[model samples]
Target: MISYLFGILSIKGKFEYFKMFLVLLSSLPNIDKRIKSIFQTIESVEDIVNIIIGGGAASLEKRASYSLEWLEQNGRCLDHIYSRLSDIPSAGRGAFSRRFIKKGEVVITSPLLAFQKSQLEEFYDKNNKIVPPPDFESRQVILNYCFSHPKSSLALFPLTHAMLINHASVRKGSNRHPNAKIRWATDHTETQKS
Candidate 1:
C-alpha cells in the first residue's frame, strides 16, 4: 500500500519521508498561496511524484521528523484498567477486578472500525425481498467476522474485549444485563456499570 501510494520502485527506509510530504502538502497553512508560490499548479500525479522525489526531499525530511516527534509525544491513548485474569474451568478467559466499581462508572471502551452497513444493505435488502445469492449467507457471516476482527483497525467493533461479558437477557419483564450496561455509537462503544 505504501509503495502504491508513493509510486516508488524501492522505498527502502523512506516511508516516513513520503508520508510527511503528503501531510505537509495537503495541510499547508495557506494552501492556495503556497501552491501558487511553489509550483503555480500541480498538473498530474506524476509531476507531484517527481517533485517529491527531487526538489521537496529536504522539506519532506524536515516535516517528517517534526510529525514523528509530535506523534511520539501524543499519539497513543491506552490503559483503561489494570485487572486480573480469571479462567472458568470449561469456558474462556475473562477479566476480573476485586476493586469496588462505583455506579455509572466506565469499565471499558473501544473504538469501532468502519462498519460494513452499506455492504450488508447491498446483500440483504429485506424491504425489497432481496436476499443474498444462495449460499451467500454463510459468506456474509465470515465477512462480518472479518470486518469486526481484521488484523488492522478496520473492524466493525475493533478490540471489543468487553464483549466477552455475557449480556444474557433476563427471563421476566426485562431482557438486559442487570448490573452492567453497554452503549454504542457510530464509531465507538462504552461499557458502564450501573
Candidate 2:
C-alpha cells in the first residue's frame, strides 16, 4: 500500500486527513536531508542552509496551494497525497531559521566591517610603541572566527518546523481576523499642525 501510494496511483478526494497525509508523505525526503545536514554542519552551516530552505519552503507553499486546488478539481488523489506530505513538514512557516540557530554559537554580522590598517597603526603609536608589531596571527584568528559563524544562523530541523507552524498559524489567523484592532494613537493634532 505504501509503495502504491508512493508510486503510480494518484488518488483524488476532498477528505482533510487524506490531504494532510499526502502532504506529509511528499515532504519526508526533504525533511530527512534537512535533519541530517543540521548535525553535519554543526559549527557554521546554519545561515546559508536556513536561507536556502526558507526560500524553498516559501516557493513550495505557493506552488502547493495552487496544486492542491488543481488536484481537488481533477480527482488526482496522488497529487493530493504529495501535497499533504509536503504541507505537514512545512506547516511551521519560520522553522528553518529558528532551527538553524538553536545551537549556542556566535554569528558574525558583517565580515567586511573591519578596522583600517592606518587606524591600527595609530592606536599602536598612541600606546607608546616604537614600531607596531604585526598582528597577522590575531587578524587570522579573527577571520577564522568570523568564517566559523554567520549572522543568519538557525536551529535544528525538528525545532525549526515547530516554529514555522506556529508562525504560519499566527499569519493565517491575522489574515482571517482582519477586523482585530491594532492599537495606534493617530496624531491628529500633528496632522493639523503640519
Candidate 3:
C-alpha cells in the first residue's frame, strides 16, 4: 500500500500527506462532484498529486492559490497565502506567507461547521442515557486523546477533514510573535464580518 501511494506521489513527504488526504477523501459523499467543482480537468495522476498535496517550494511561496504559472493563469492578489507542513518548533503544521501582509489584512474567510457544547452534550446524553454535560475533565481528556491521535481513532477531526484553519497562534508575551489577530462567531446563518 505504501508503495502504491508512493508511486502516486514521487515525493516521500507528499506520500505521507497523501495518506491523510485519502482519509479526508473517503468521508466526502460526492467525491467525483467535489473534484469536478474544484478543478476544470484532471490531466494525469501527477496533476492530482500536485492539486492535493503541494507547497514544497524552497525560495518563494508558489503563488497559483499557493505559483508563477498559477498567477499567470489566474491574476494577482495583494497577498498570496499558502498552506504547508510547518517547520516550527513544537508544532505540527500551519499557514505561512512568502510576501508582505498588511496590518489589518483579511486572509481567508470560509464557512466552518461547528457543534455547540450544549447540543453535543444533549446528543450524547440521549444516546448513552446519562445526564447531559459530562464532567469537564473527562470531556477534556477525551478531546485531548481525539486531537492527539487523529489518524489513530478520531479520523473525523476537522484537521484531517481539510476543514482546519491553520492559523499561527500568537505566542504569549511576545509582541512580534503574531501581529494579527483572529475573531470568529458561532452563528452559521450569519457570515463572519470584520
Candidate with best TM-score? 3
Q: How accurate is candidate 1 locally (lDDT)?
A: 0.37
- Candidate 1, position 54, lDDT: 32
Residues 16-96 of candidate 2: C-alpha lDDT, one tens digit per residue = 332322232223233444333332232222322333344323223222234766646532111111111223342222222
User: Candidates ranked by TM-score, best first?
Assistant: 3, 1, 2
Query: Lowest-scoring 10 consecutive residues by lDDT in candidate 1?
Result: 55-64
Assess candidate 2 and give its lDDT.
0.28
Off by over 4 Å in 1: 1-91, 117-155, 168-178, 184-194
Residue 59, model 2: lDDT of 25
Please report how far candidate 1 places residue 136 from its true position, in Å. 10
lDDT tens digits, residue span 88-135, model 1: 342222334336557677656544334443333333222344443323
How many backbone clashes does every candidate have? 0, 30, 4
Q: What is the lDDT of residue 74 in candidate 3?
A: 37
What's the TM-score of each model vs. the native? 0.30, 0.16, 0.34
User: Each candidate's root-mean-square deviation in Å?
Assistant: 17.2, 23.9, 12.0
TM-score of 2: 0.16
